[model samples]
Target: MKTDILKFQNLNPEKETQISNLFKQLGGEKKQIPLKEVLEEGNHITLAYCEHNDQVVGIASMCAYHVISGKKGWIEDVVVDEQFRGQGIGRKLMEKLLEEGKKKKLTEILLFTEAHRIPAIKLYGDLGFKLKESRIYTLKMP
Candidate 1:
C-alpha cells in the first residue's frame, strides 16, 4: 500500500468526514473539529494524516507552544484504521509530526499512551521516546 503523509490545510467537508471516522477508529467520540477555525486561527495546532489512494488511513496531531524553557511539542490523537494497522502508516504519521517539531525548533516532544497499547508503546520506543516517571492528572469540566 502506498501511503503519503499530508499536513492538513484547506480542508473541506468530505475530508472532515473522513477525519471523524479516523478518530472513531482510535476510540474517540465522534465529533467534528472546527477545521476552518483551526486553520485560519493560529493556535499552534498541526494535524498530520496518512493517506492511501486518496483515502485517509491514519492521523496524528501536535500542539506546540513556547514555554519558559523553550518550545515544546505534544503529540496527541494518533490512530490508524484497524485494517491498515501494522503497515507503517502510524509510523509515517509520527514521522511527519517529528519533522514538524524539528522545523519549529521544539526543545522537546512528549506524548502519553495507554499501558495496554503494547504495540503503540513499542512504536513510541522505536521512535526514541522514553517513559518518564511523571504523574498525569486530568479533570472534566461541566
Candidate 2:
C-alpha cells in the first residue's frame, strides 16, 4: 500500500499519539515534548509526516528564519519507522519540506546528524546537503 505525506500542523488525537511514538524512535533518552507543544512550536516551523493505514510512519521538520545571512531553514528530527525505512518515505517528507523552503525562498537549508547515523548522512548527502566545516556546540538549559 502507498503512504501519504502531509504537513503536520493540525492533527487528530489518534494520529497525534502515533506520531509521538514515531518520534520516540529518534530520541532514546531524550524526553519528548508534550504532543500539544510538539505541534504548536511556531508558525516558522513546518512539519511533514507520512502515514500508512492511518498510522503515522514517518516525520520530518524544518524551521525557517531570517538571520543576517538571509532567510534560512534548519531541518530537524527526521525519522521513519523501522519497518518503513528504505521505502523512500523519509525522502518524500524531506522533499515536501524542501518544497516549503523553496516557496519561502530560503537562502540555505542546514541540518546536523551524528556521524554514527551513516544511512541518514548518506540520505542527506544524496539530497544535496554538504558536510559543513563548522563545529557544533550545545549547552543544555535547565
Q: Which parts of model 2 have CA positions greater than 4 angstroms off?
A: 1-9
- Error at 47, model 1, angstroms: 0.6
Candidate 1 per-residue lDDT over residues 1-142, each given as its tens digit? 4434333455878877788778887774535566665555567888888777777888888899998988999998899999889999888888888998999999999999999999999999999999999999988666
TM-score of 2: 0.89
- Colliding pairs, model 1: none
Each prediction's total of clashing residue pairs, residues at least 3 apart in sequence or on different chains, is 0, 0
Worst 10 residues of 2 by lDDT: 1-10
Reference-based lDDT, each prediction:
0.82, 0.82
